[model samples]
Target: MNYFKQILRFAKPYRIYAILNIISNIFYALFGTLAMVSLFPMLNVLFGKTDKVKIKPEWNGLLKVREYSEAYLNYYVTQKADQGNDDVLIFMVALVISMFFLKNIFSYLAMYFITFLRNGVLKDIRNELYKKTVDLPLSFFSEKRKGDTIARISTDVLEIQHSFLSILELIVREPLMILFTICAMLLISVKLTVFVFIFIPISGFLISLIGKRLKKHSDKVQKEQGFFLSIVEETLGGLKVIKGFNAEKIFNRKFKESTSRFYNYSNTLLNRQNLASPTSEFLGITVIAILLWYGGQMVLVEKSLDPGLFIVYMGLAYNILTPAKAISKASYGVKRGNAAAERVLEILNTSSPLQDKPDAQEKRDFNTDITLENISFKYEDEYVLDDFSLRVPKGSAIALVGQSGSGKSTIANLVTRFYDVNKGSIKIDNTDIRDLTKESLRGLMGLVTQDSILFNDSIKNNLLIGDEHATEEEIIDALKVANAWEFVKDLPKGIETNIGDSGNKLSGGQKQRLSIARAVLKNPPIMILDEATSALDTESERLVQSALENMMKNRTSIVIAHRLSTIQNSDLIVVMQKGKIIEKGRHEELIAKNGAYQRLVTLQSFD
Candidate 1:
């Protein structure tokens, strides 16, 4: 219930629709009760029990209001009785039909308004969930499956809409209908209505017992759904690897195992949910059967209660059954909804560690240089970079040459503030990067990674991510600067060409070059290239290396280099080993030293 209350806040934006729905439901309940109560007059007319009255009934106080109303109705019916019983019967039937007609109309209207409120809340929740997903730090996702996040946003949200949102209708309509029906039954006879109340609590208790474990089962089913979805997402991402390794049967068996659990959990949850309706209905029938025997004794043998009124009381009692069944079903829905709301709120309530400070300044420009001072960081336990210090003077290409696990890429990540340092500070022009707003800090740099990260979008649209308002001529110029225009100009749609998933439509070199072009379009003061050409073939590397060289000119660049031949012209080549710089000098000066740098050059020459 606490989780449900939290989810209901999303309904605030559509509160007007909620208000409208409540109003319509109120009328629907009123008319629905009246439709059943109208049976009292019709029964009296059918039984020929209506009596004629000569005098108009006097207005009585509220205590005898029921008697006064019955006298007035009898006076009117007696006037119509002179017309014929057939005509009076027709009028009574017409009155019942009108009540039913109005009840159904309000019922339709209640559903109509609720549609807007329900879907509006759905849209708003999904939108907020997506925004939260994007805003969370990368480290948050390190321990979570992508498919679980997807399931929370997609299926779990839908479950909330179906289950929790239905409570809005049940809250107003069902209880009001029951309240009105109970009031009318009390007007007819308080003793029998008291008997009806006794069975209700017992029925409610039984229904509750069945639904007690529904939430636990529902949680298991949703988790299994996420598990299977994760397997599918993994399978799609690594389809080629799976085929190359011939592991289809392995994945198939894994998927089947997950689904088998899901099947059992779903059946258990649904069977419990399905039990609510019949259990409530059977309990209601049992109450009804008891009322018939007790009321029969009072009417036929004791002659204390009227037959027509008892018949009407039975109709009103029967009217309580529909709403009771609905309420019992909705109780189960609320339980299921509680489980779903917990999953959704888990994401929404997570506080990102990377949030900017209240007084964080917006630093938009890069003047002077970037510096790392005694920075220490870690992803989990052991530090990836410890006491790492470096400086990049403006407009100089500083290349980091290192063996794998030498923390070259870790430096790139720290510079970009993708993950902040555990100790010490990274400063731009002497101001700590943490003091600057993340947006403005990131705006000063461009990044190109080992993998060419491109989306399944138009080539033009992909470049627009770097500069959304870039003109055609500016885009073409950036492409030329990255040496990508040659291949791009040959494609059928040229700049407008759609690059398929992750730009798989382009060759490795073409993809890498476009990534460079995107960075060039931003034209930032600092650039970080993390082994950007390592995955390419010889020919592709040559082309991409040329593009990198062109883009790095006159810019402050940090290059994490793999191919020893590529960074020979760099202003400073810092060779690192085990997170520490073992050698630092220009390429020619390092070659003259005949030490670690020279050894690396010699090894590459042999390769």
Candidate 2:
């Protein structure tokens, strides 16, 4: 119930729809009772028990509304039949028909109104989850699989919508119907109704006991599903590697094990959930058998109840079982939904590590040098940077050159605030980046990694993400500056061509150039290139580096260079070893020093 209350907060904006759904449910319950009550007069007509009492009689009490409505209906039918157009039996039949019609009509309205609230809440919840996922720190993603996140967003959230919300409707509406039906049954025969109460509680206790295990099994099923999805995502992302290593059988075994466990958990959950229907039905029939024996004597042997009245009481008694069964099924559904809801809320409830402070200010521009003052960072147990310090003037290109794990890329990430430093400060123009709004700080820098992260979207749309309001001419000019215009112009649709996922449709060099083009279009004051040309061939590297240098001409740039030649003309080159800078100077000075920088340059010269 507490979880449902938390979920209902998403419905606040659509409260009007929720109110309308409740109102319609009220009418739906009324119609359900009225439709059952309508059977009484028809049974009377069939048994030749029509009354000649005052038809439109008024009343005052709890039953007054029911009595008045019955009287008004009786009078209208009798008045019409007095003209010899129809018999009293026909009028009673018409009342029964109208009751059923209103019953279904109100039911439809209730469902329609609830749809608006359910779907609106679904949209809002997903939107908020997406925003939270994007807002969370990069370190959070580093610890979790992307596919598991995808499973939470797509499959798990939708399951909650289907399972939880559907049960919520039944929880609210069906119980009211059951209550109204039981009350009417009591009016007919309190003795028989009291008998029903005994068995219902016993059945409910059994059903609840069975359902206690459902949430546990459901959680296992969902967890396994996430594991399988993670495997699929990994396999697809690294299909080339899998094929190269001939590891298909190994991955297949892993996937099969995960799915097999999922299958067992699903079976456990479904078997328990499926028990609700048959268990409730068996209990209901047992109660009815008892009533048939006891109430039969009341009708025939003792003359305690009329046959027609007994028949209507049986109908009302049966009505209670329908809603009771629905409730049992809904209870199982709620348990299943709880598992998925917990997963979804796990993501939604997680607080972002990098969130704007209440007093955070938006930085308008960078007017001075960028400084890393004795900055230190660690990823979990491994320290990547230890007391690292560097300074870049307002518009200077500083290239970092070192071995793979020398913390070159970490510097770029730290400067962009992708991951917060463990110690010391990163200041832009003397203003600590932490004090500025994340959006404002990020807006000032453009980043291009080795992967050239591009989406499966048209080239124009990709460029538009850099500056959504950029004119067509500006997009084309940016592409030209990145040396991507030649290939794009040769394509069938030019900038409108769709680049496949991660730009797999483009060559390695083409993807990097397009990436550079996007950064050029952004036109940020600071550019971070982390091994931007590392993945390309010699010809492509030359073209990409040319465009990169063009873009970095006046911008404050941080380059993590893999090919030594790219940073030869760089203003400063910092050589890192372990978690500290081992050398720092121009390329010529590093060669003169003949240290780690000199060894790296000599190695690249041979390659």
Candidate 3:
């Protein structure tokens, strides 16, 4: 219930809908009890047990209104009997039908209003979850599974809707229905109703015992679902690898294992949750049977209760069972929903370690060099950048050549502040990158990675991400600069062609060219090319290298170089081994030293 109240704050926007639903529920409860109680007059008339009133019943106080109502009905029926009206029973039946009709109408109104509140809370929570997923630092995702996040946003939220938020239906309509029915039963015979109260608490306590372990099982079921979903997500993303390694059987076994756990957990949870309904109903019937024995004695043996009113009392007593059953089921739902609420609130309540300070402002442009001074950083226990430092002058192209895991790419990540250093600071034009707003700091640079991250959208839309208001001509010009215009114009739709998922419709080199065109469109003062052309064949690499040179013109560039020959003409070349810089100089100066750079060039046969 505490978890439920936390999520209820989202209903503030739709408070009017909730209020209207409560109002409708109050009427529905009133009408529902009246509908059952209306059966008494019909029963009395059918049994010919009604009394003939000699005088009209006087208006009595509220407490005795039930007696006055019965007295008035008796006088009307007796007058009709003396008038020789054969439609008296027909009129009574029609009145009963109208009471039932009004009851259903208000019941529908309650559900209709509650629909808005339930769905509105779902929309707001999912939107906030998605927003937080995007805003949290990338490091947050490193320790979590993507499918678990997807489950939190999709399945867990829906579970909360069904279990937690849907409790609104049970809280108002069902409880009030029980209250009204109980009150009506008291009016008919307070003695029988009092006997009912003593046993109901014991029944309620037993029903609650089923829900005690349900929450723990439900959490296990939800987590198992997330595990299987993660397996599916991983399998889809790695189909090519699975086929390449001929490990399809291995991954299939992994998926099967996760699904098997899911099956067991879900069955255990659902079967226990299913027990709540029958247990409550079975207990309710036991109470009803006991009421029959006692009430029958009061009427038949004791001669203290009337037969027709006792029949009405039994009808109203049965009415309470439906609501009691509903309440029992709802209690189980709340238990399950509590687990989902905890999962959802976990994301919403997490404080991001990466956020701009209150005094931060947008850094509009770059004017001077980028300086990395003795920056030390570690991802886990080991330092990836051990007291690394470098000075990249404005408009100068610096190429980084190193073996894999030599911390070349880490420099790109740090300069863009995708990560912050543990010990030292990076400055752009003498201002610490941390002091600048992340958005504006990143806006001053362009990044083109080796993987060529492109979306499934039209080529024009993809290019427009670099410049939203770019005209068609601007897109064509940027493509030409990327050496991609020739291939794009040959396609059927030219700039309007839809690139399939991750631009799969385009070839590797074409995708790379389009990626470069996106950065070219941005035309930032600084460019970071993280092995942008490394994955291409010789022909594709040559064309992409040409495009890279064109984009690097008049820009300060940091090139994480993969091909040794490509960076021979760079203004400065730095060779790295481990996390330390082993050599730094012009390409020719390093080649003359017969040092690490020269050895790597010989290996590539670029000397």
Which of the numbered candidates is closest to the native, going by highest lDDT? 1
**Model 2, stretches more than 4 Å misplaced?**
54-86
lDDT of 1 by residue, 176-244 (tens): 999988988888888888888888889889889999999999999999999999999999889989999
lDDT of 3 by residue, 1-607 (tens): 8889999999999999999999999999999998888888888888888898979899889899789999999998887777664667887888899889998999899899989999999999999999999888877889888889999999999999999877888889888999899888878788889999999999999999888999899999888788778888988878889999999999999888988888898998999998988899999999999999999999999999999888888888889999999889988999999999999999999888668888887888888899999999888899988988899999999999899999999999899888888988899999888888888998999999999999989999999999998889999999999999999999999999999988988889999999999999988999999999889899999999999999999999999999987788899998988888999999889989998988898888842
Work out the TM-score per prediction.
0.97, 0.95, 0.96
Q: Give the Cα-based TM-score of candidate 2 against the true structure.
A: 0.95
lDDT of each: 0.91, 0.86, 0.90
> Across residues 495-552, which tens digit of lDDT does each residue of candidate 2 receive?
9999988889999999999999999999999999999999899999999999998899
Error of 2 at 1 (Å): 2.5
Determine the backbone clash count of candidate 2. 0
Q: How many angstroms is residue 128 displaced in model 1 relative to the true structure, after the best TM-score fit?
A: 0.6
Model 3: which ten-residue window has the lowest total lDDT?
79-88
| Candidate 3 off by > 4 Å | 76-84
How many steric clashes between backbone atoms does each model show?
A: 0, 0, 0
Worst 10 residues of 2 by lDDT: 46-55
Q: What is the lDDT of candidate 2?
A: 0.86
